[model samples]
Target chain A: MYVAVKGGEKAIDNAHKYLAEERRGATDVAELSLSQISEQLSHAVSRVMAEGSLYDKDLAALAIKQARGDLIEAIFLIRAYRTTLPRFGYSAPLDTSEMDLDRRISATFKDLPGGQVLGPTFDYTHRLLDFALAAEGLEPQKAEAAEAPLDEEVPRVLELLNAEGLIEQSAPADYDDTAPVGDLTREPLEFPADRDLRLQNLARGDEGFILALGYSTQRGYARNHAFVGEVRLGDVTVEVIPEELGFAIEIGDITITECETVNQFQGSKTAPAQFTRGYGLAFGHSERKVISMALVDRALRCHELGEDQVAPVQDDEFVLSHSDNIQATGFVEHIKLPHYVDFQSELELVRRLRRNAEDNIREAAE
Target chain B: MALDSSPGDPSRKNWMGILARASETDLENFWQLHGQEEDYDFLRRPEIGLVMVQGRAGGTGGRFNLGEMTVTRCSVRLSDGTVGHAYIAGRNQRHAELAAAFDALLQNPERQEEIEDTVITPLQKRHQQGRDDRSKKAAATKVDFYTMVRGED
Candidate 1:
């Protein structure tokens, strides 16, 4: 009666055993350590952490190792692990104005305050393959003396323009800074999302998918002219307050990447022309992700800006809903699960309809 | 954004920060030697679970699911009525229990100074040292160029 269940349990158990064995790979080869993955492959760990939405470098490292360096798989592992923990409390949003700047640059200004730091970027690197890195066991060099810590604050490029009424105002005319942000994880996302919600979606959106969508906007999909106002990467303090304590405490610092792009705007009938901004921020030094996100952010703002929403990336619901890889991957991979019961019923219905049609045709012939 | 308003009253915030930043090993080792003599009942037994991580594109933008990570959390109440809770990243139940024990100890007014000196100070030092090491490595690559002043003949 339930032949589908027969032998499946044992087969599944053995399959898991085989997978564990396969995960070990060749025993002769030295196994990759979590520390190596966390340190040497830090960028990968950062990407997984960013995409997984959890900031623990240790967990991300373990995930990468467990997933055999498959980043999406590692992200999935991190995501699943994150779901069960108790919510300590929401962290106070970071004050990036005081970011411990690692990398800061402005495309709009040649010599901006907090002079450009091209820190460890691949931008100027030749793409030549380094044969030296192919071999193993290089001695860990002692670190050089650190730079004196940057002053706690730096002038943001966007703020400089805002002071002169160049960029569109960030807050509303009567902006309440205390308004509760929409948490997409806690509640369903409503259409025509506010800037905060849209940013949240993009922040966790698949970097590759968001990059392509953002790229699309640049490639004439929504040809909005944009100049990189500022790009900064740094560590920001995370602070949280317990309800019982009734006061704030610094939790820790997390590294973040922020991009602010100034887009060209024309005067509409009701409003005067001003430079509107598109913003992107992500968990780590995801320069590409942030830049792409900024472009898409501007593209998505077309309707709000009184511009025609002709581009695919400009479709708010379409972009927001499809951007998450976890949601997308879960739904897509679910297809492999057993669907024979539903398929059988549909098959029966089609056969019955065909028989009825044949009988009707015979009667008509007679 | 209002979430940043100085978290709760400041006094407890400082200690909670200490609690949040300590590595699992540091907390465990500290508890193993110092805080292990206390009697406590499980208010919540240590268990593994998931938390949905959310991220905002660029740091302050809209939120999206980052993914999940495994966490172990435990809660306990000391015999003397002090309550404690602990949540650490990953699936180590022993670490959670030790953390919970230490958390209760930190809340104890009588033991606060003792625990802070023995546990928090060492952990903070380690965290700072780690940061210093990272900063040093990154700073090695820092390049600075100076502009020359024009000279009039």
Candidate 2:
């Protein structure tokens, strides 16, 4: 191997070829298909969509395959692709109330109006891995359908608390026309973002960062008891109401997992104690991410609700500002960029200082 | 009215005529922007600024210098009880007002709809227009021209 190299472009191409061969494995075996990844490795696809901030399963699966199963790399691929796509018009927010019932459940009340539809969840399955799956001999079994029809809206569990005046009053819904906070992608994120924008950032934030922040809450960095008020996973139609159309046209259906957490909070002496809310919603069926998001959300509500701010996790501004994986990782990794100019300045200063010290030593010896 | 993503203020109306008829969407979408977050409450309460600067000193212990910057900050208690703090790098009254108004609107249950329609949309429009203009200007300056003489070979 030569100590000096000049064929950077050629080296890069060769390295890429080697990587591709390694990723594809043996020529004797058939290459993996995108469909297989989407079906069998759905969780990776979901994570990519959640972090990459895109909702297409096929694209996510392709990214995963192309990235050699690196979810973060897959997310980077989707994000890069998303940046190049031309922006059409904005679609109106999806109406969850009109969302076709898929999987709806309320932990507050076991048998609510919308009967708990387990949907496709790993909750009931034993932790033990099935050895038959390794041999590809097992067939998935479908569960029997329950007789009861689930309701359209499983009336939010918080409503029950609101009736008794036990929980925080629902913030008035009169602000529908408010412009959404500017995207951090277009511009940098300024501090003190509102709860809505902050939540959006957290939803699209890196999984590991949010997971760590959420873990801090459990470790008593901020103690807000979080109860999974609702965790629903299913498809929701994306509708765009074109000016000429005069009505919403269904773009497509996207699978989403929404988790809303009800947190226990003690109010100031002037006000009665109530359960505050921390909501988490993410694209695709990502219950783990959703649950993690909800916990972090609750922890961030300390200052807003007049609760004593005792933990780092309780700082809304800090958590929301720092939890973004893209920004955090980008800033952290950007140190690899050319810093030779600054390093050169330091190097000159060091040589001068060392020479001065050596001169002082020589003078003392004389 | 200005679009949500545009730069400069329509209310200030300083350069409104030049931007009014622009395709607001195109203007807003064309450029990259960076946002800075400042701790307004911390700055205003104590009336002091602590600016941190780090540099390598003699390739030994890293050196840190605390320089004072003229920082202006404000806090707004929105009608809905949400308080927003905005601190800018310099003493710009307009930036403070804009930040405060945005803060108020973000939390106002009553005026949110009106504020979005009247304020945010127009600002965004202006911002976008400026971005598009700059990008086009940059594109125009980009030259990738080369030539070779046929007889020389």
Candidate 3:
């Protein structure tokens, strides 16, 4: 039970003032601008956006600034701000196949349609610290441009396997857009959650948490022999068919990272052995997060695929309930918020019980 | 609000995509130069809202809610009664208003060619240039694997 204790109004106000001053840091240093955070610390902003479940880069950057670089705090701020805004509608499910490809690669196949394009990535970079970045006014070398541009559309690697029926199809044969999809934001997540709900949960799940869960699976805790089928990063146009407009109009584009994992699935008596699929998608270039999401996604699909649910990751309720960091942080951190009354009640009970026990022992002796 | 009688016009979709994706600064400059004198009334005032973004299960399967993105939408009716609607990403009120105003203006047959030339064309060029620059750089990074012949072979 929570009790509202009054008083300390002046102290609370002064504490906030001190916090503001502290947030400014040393006066000699130039202030960090929102643009700088949005541009330079973009990966941080992306994580906040992905976890916060909001897409406004500027607002995410501002939240990061307000939270003093505490990403979870920034995500909390974003989530809070999101609740206040009115919802317009839902966008058409993004067609990632038509995405303006920046980075596309496949681990399962060396050569595939729309040959591997390595866009801007740190995969090949040595992890040594570049002190040159610390000093300002350093002009970075420009990247070389190819004589000819890449193809407009690149086929997904999974599509190649789908052609030969070697891998299970990702979409249903009778997929319909009009069919209502489960939205956890609008409704509470119920048990026996479908793949849609699971994906949504993992999409916004805490990166580190999801990464750990995915890594555990790799260490033989429900290992599916996962192969990185494809990882693509680029901008995809978002379209919403406004009621008034009666036709779809592009709202804008958002950069996202998508991962598709091909897992080994031994066929049953009635079915033929074919590779299965796991999917992960998140806002911005969240490579690690998406990859983790894909692995967890596949693990949660054990029941559907007729596999034994022997691991924690295979349990949908456990993964989905604890995936959201905002929810997790609130329950964990609420203990710090004035639990004095509750503690006092417990203290009194303990003292009374101890006294009664001592008195009973003395009476017996007498 | 009256619906667009001919919603199947592909050009309208293309131009709207371009306008929605155009940078805020560029849109503002274009509006100031070509559309400052345009008269329109707000059917729906510029309001910030959320649009739930959905994604496919396996990039080709059933749909699922990914997350909500910030979108500002507005509706405007021109003096000549042509209605324009804008649903752009992000929370810029002025950007929505300007895009709606242009949409209404672009719908006018008399002014269509002129506005398309003066405003939309330049914006499209700038947008194309930015896309090409990034695509080219990415193209440069495409790996070309080569196999070396061993002396034993």
Candidate 4:
């Protein structure tokens, strides 16, 4: 009888060697630079940074190159690295009011304080693909802007709703004073999660997973009519106030896409009639992700706003608990690991069933 | 609660906490049986169970256990004046302790660095030593059987 093979170490070592060789294909050619990846494959970099939960452009670019441009692998690398980094201190919650926005647009109002400046968007671009870029060694020319900068702070759309008392006031008193928000990474997701936990899930949740969950709401599952109250793409300041310093220090700026959704909600006996909120904020320019997140967030608020828990997709506990792609991926991939013992038991049961059937057939014949 | 107590007290204050722990021991036992304690701990708390789940070299099934394991876990202090926990796989006690220390660190925000250096590093080294001990025992058990074959017509 052929016994089980036992050269796994050698096989794994050889596989690594082969992988290294494949990763560095065409050894004569110069390897792609991190700066090139960051600049050229910016969208991929953004996605990696967003999902990886690390905002460093250079490191993300390096991850992309190291993972052979596999965005998910790049994200995995970033996450692994992120887990290792020592938690020195946490910066206080960002004040978006002081954000120096590079690009800000409000879909709710046409003429806001900050007039809409269409900054580097593909909304008006022609459908035809540009073939001229394929030609080698062509130096790109910078396009000149025709319009002057509309330097005005766009009033928050939510603020407008609040002014009319149309939206529920998100007062600080609503949150628990003693028990603050806990990091989702540190703790296992529990059922009947609060808004903070749900938001945390949306923030770190896989784009595709959030997108699909968000889509379910629009397909009449949650029946939440979501309007993009505001979608602001800008550079938000990250302030670090050291214990020794005792004052807020401007560490750096990070690109963020913040989307706030307004959904219709009727006042029940216990709650007042108001517009519920679904907020989405992601690292880098992930508009689709942010918008989708907002929708999902609003749908999840059905129970909190004293509305009927009408849909499976709207259940805060279910959605928040099962939203993590990392957990899902790990469990799914673990199935590839050893299961022979389980398989053996299954095989024995099947054999016994077959023998019993054969005996019945023989008895009938006799 | 006395720091320098009589040996016979058994520490009821600490004992109640242990009792509380034993009450919820079913989950821990369930994990000990089916779940890879180290892997689960690693995800939850990196500092405690930093020992890697070294897969078997080769076997009938994919990545058999081969009755060998190394694990790291951490006991932590919760913010609510309660002790916390995390257990992980692997020899990185620093990983476990950092996770544990981080749990403690998150609660107080005062003694982050002290815990990092004092608790995390030593635990990591101990975890590695445990792995080394297991490997050494396995190595000592190694034996080879040989036979001289006689010429047969």
Candidate 5:
């Protein structure tokens, strides 16, 4: 039993107008500019880009402004805008090795190549809030330049382990460049997904959800003795081979955070004992997200790695289905939208049952 | 546009990259000064689109879709039948058109040297300077470790 009731058009329009007024806040105060949001609230923009699966910082900032700083709402706006654009083609896979190093660190090694450059990090700072920031017009401090430049070639730490056959190779033995990768946007996700599909889903997954899952692993829920092999944040140039042009051309560069985790894996009957690997890469300086993504990535490999899948994080269907905040929010919020007919039927059934019970009690008493 | 299938010419590729990565304002200024006089027609109008960015599994593995990025592309043909194409990041149609126009002019052997001297060289220097400044700042943050000597050893 379904019915349509259309009304409140004027009320809806008024509500929207009120919302705009509320969003603007005080008239005396200056409105926040898009550049300010993009530069100052960059982490928020970065998160929106990662989850929204779009990499335009200006648009993300604009969405932030339009959504009144509700990041998920901003992400929704970006996703909607992104769906309308025509796709040119796929770009060549990004090479992290050539990233213009910003912040590169390795917890596993005390001293490695590149020597752990801590470029613009909050890691060493005190957690206490600085009252000085409240007072505007403070002069910005410039960092000192080094006498000598960093090495041209900073090698990856895992390559050292791979050289001695001490770690599992990240790529397949028979990797092909021409083979097609799985695309979730084009097709619905199926069970028993490959690493490629899983990575794609996790890359655009909700930060909070992924963080909780990663934290679960740390609390001994399908733990894999994880070690932070290396975490690098920097800019990498994006190149695409256009159909008109026969060769690749650089479009632009984007900042990304990459994490590679080495996990202890007791070799199975068919495999040799060696260190296994989990990887995470996301747009912008998302250290926590990438680190968490790596942890969950390793956990999801339980079946393939010959480990027991005993936790919710290890369940692919549960994790993948609930990871997307946009999908989760839409379904949860839809309950507020019109369930009147459904509830009315249940109400009538319950009342009828209660009446019958009361009549039966009276008859028994008589 | 005539297709030059001669492989291993790195100069054309380098210039194209420089033009793509250069700021729109800078490109516009340079175009107004030097490229405004060139007669050209649009082969394909500047169109904004998305390009799906891919990433390696472990930074060195098989490819996976990371996400899509906005790109604007255009193709133009010069009066002399030399064709130029541009694929730059972000949704700026004017920037793409200007880049395409410059690309077409650069393909002409007669105008190649002068354009390279005025437009390409200056843009390259500015880009390099920015990169150098960033690299130097990062270098300053590089950790320097020192070990204390113990008499017991």
Candidate 6:
């Protein structure tokens, strides 16, 4: 005896009503303006932009507000908007060496050139709750440090190793000038992606998933013995060469985070033993994501270096297929859809099998 | 494109930077002192809109949508028919109008020298000095390193 349910539309409407109420909990306080979300909760906006694969701050902030602070949903909102916009010309690759470093640090060398500029980091002090910050307008701010923007190009520490021919020099992985750029958004991703396409895919990959893969590697899954060579956060000027204009003009600047890992690569038949490099670049101060990306990137490079692919991270098909939040979310959410029709058929089949078994038992008894 | 290049200084980028750095007070004071007499008509009225600011991944790569920023832009023409344009950050409509007017006036040969000396030159100097001083102070904290050269058998 089975009863089929109805009113899916009504159920969906009521669910939305509940969501609205939950979103605006205690409306007497105030509705958050998009500007407040953009400026105050900037890291969230940055994350949405990075993960959404879009860079618009205002749109990201709006998405955050509309999505009730769900970072992934906000990312989805931005992505939807981004798809509608026409493609402008692409800019030249960012030169991190010439970055206007706001914060640059190294874990390898104690002292390196362009001394570690520890600018506005949460690294030092501390997880302890500041009770004063909970209340509004209590303490007056101290005057900002006399505005000395050093604007010095902090050179990478690995460059020193690179100078001595200690690190493997980067060559074009697949030698082809004017190689056609691969876009995951435009075309479905294929197996054994090139470095350019792989990086692009990973750059916009799900932060949590990428972090997990990276974590697995750190827990000795791939065990590359990687160290954070250099981590930098700064703005890089974007330039586009117009077909008519014939030269590049600085379109604007974008804030970015870049991570480089000095990885241990054992000498193989073709190559000698030296340090290998993994690069991670993201839209904003996304250290964790970028760091994770670097680790996963190195892990993915196992096959190319003639290393055994024993781990899940070493499987490009598994890693790339599952990394995208949009695809994962879509498939994951689809399960919540009404599946009565599908389940009813399965239920009927099981019932028929059970009835047949009972008849067989009765026959055996006779 | 009536001589996009400034005569004394050909770099419009430098002047644009100066204009961007100019405060409301500086813009207002300049008009009060010398720009009051300029007769200009609006070629393009001041209006605020979102401009898609783009960033390239790595410095050079495939384009990613960096984000959109609000920009207030306007254009004006002087009585002598010198056209001027202003593109500025934020939604400040009045500032855009004033900037547009000054842009037209600056193009006028009669007013170019006076505007260049009085408004442009001083602002450029101040901006340059501010940048130099900041860089110098930052340089003070720089750390120099020396590596040991090892000899192997």
lDDT of 5 by residue, A312-339 (tens): 9998998888999899998888777777
Better of 4 and 6 by DockQ: 6
> What is the DockQ score, from 0 to 1, of model 6?
0.17
Lowest summed lDDT window (length 10), candidate 4 chain A: A143-152
lDDT tens readout by residue for model 4, A1-366: 123445589878999999889998998988889899999888787788777766667778989999998877787787787666544344445555545454556677666665554545566689788888778688996444333333435567777787898976654334443354545666776777666666666776788988988998889888788888777666554443334334443333456777777787678799678876777777777888888988987787776666688887788777776666666776777677667677788899999999999999999999
Residue A246 Cα positional deviation in candidate 5, in Å, after optimal superposition: 1.6
> What DockQ results do all the predictions give, each relative to the true complex?
0.25, 0.01, 0.82, 0.01, 0.77, 0.17
Model 5 per-residue lDDT tens digits across residues B122-146:
9999998887788888899988888
**lDDT values for all models:** 0.74, 0.57, 0.91, 0.57, 0.89, 0.71
lDDT of 5 at B5: 29
Q: Residues B28-141, candidate 2, lDDT per residue (tens digit)?
A: 332112112212222122121211111111101112110111233444443344443333333344454345435434334454466455555665676555444433332332
lDDT of 2 by residue, A1-366 (tens): 113334578878999999999999899988989999999898898888878876667778899999999887788787777665434344445445444445656676665555555655576789898777777556776444433334435565656676888866545234333444345555666666555556667778877778788888887777787777777666554443433224433433456776777787677779878777776667777888877887887777666666788877777677777776666777878777567667778899999999999999999999
* lDDT, residue B39, model 4: 24
Q: TM-score for model 3?
A: 0.97
Q: List the residue pairs that clash in candidate 5.
A: none
TM-score of each prediction: 0.78, 0.64, 0.97, 0.66, 0.96, 0.78
| Model 1 TM-score, all chains together | 0.78
Task: Give me the TM-scores for chain A across all models, comma-separated.
Answer: 0.90, 0.87, 0.97, 0.90, 0.96, 0.93
Candidate 4 matches the true fold with a TM-score of 0.66
True contacts kept of 1: 0.29
| lDDT of prediction 2 | 0.57
- The 10-residue segment of model 6 chain A with minimum total lDDT is A242-251
lDDT (tens digit, per residue) of candidate 3 on A256-335: 99999999767889989899999999999899999999999999999988899988999999999999999999999988
DockQ value for model 3: 0.82
Which candidate has the top score in DockQ? 3
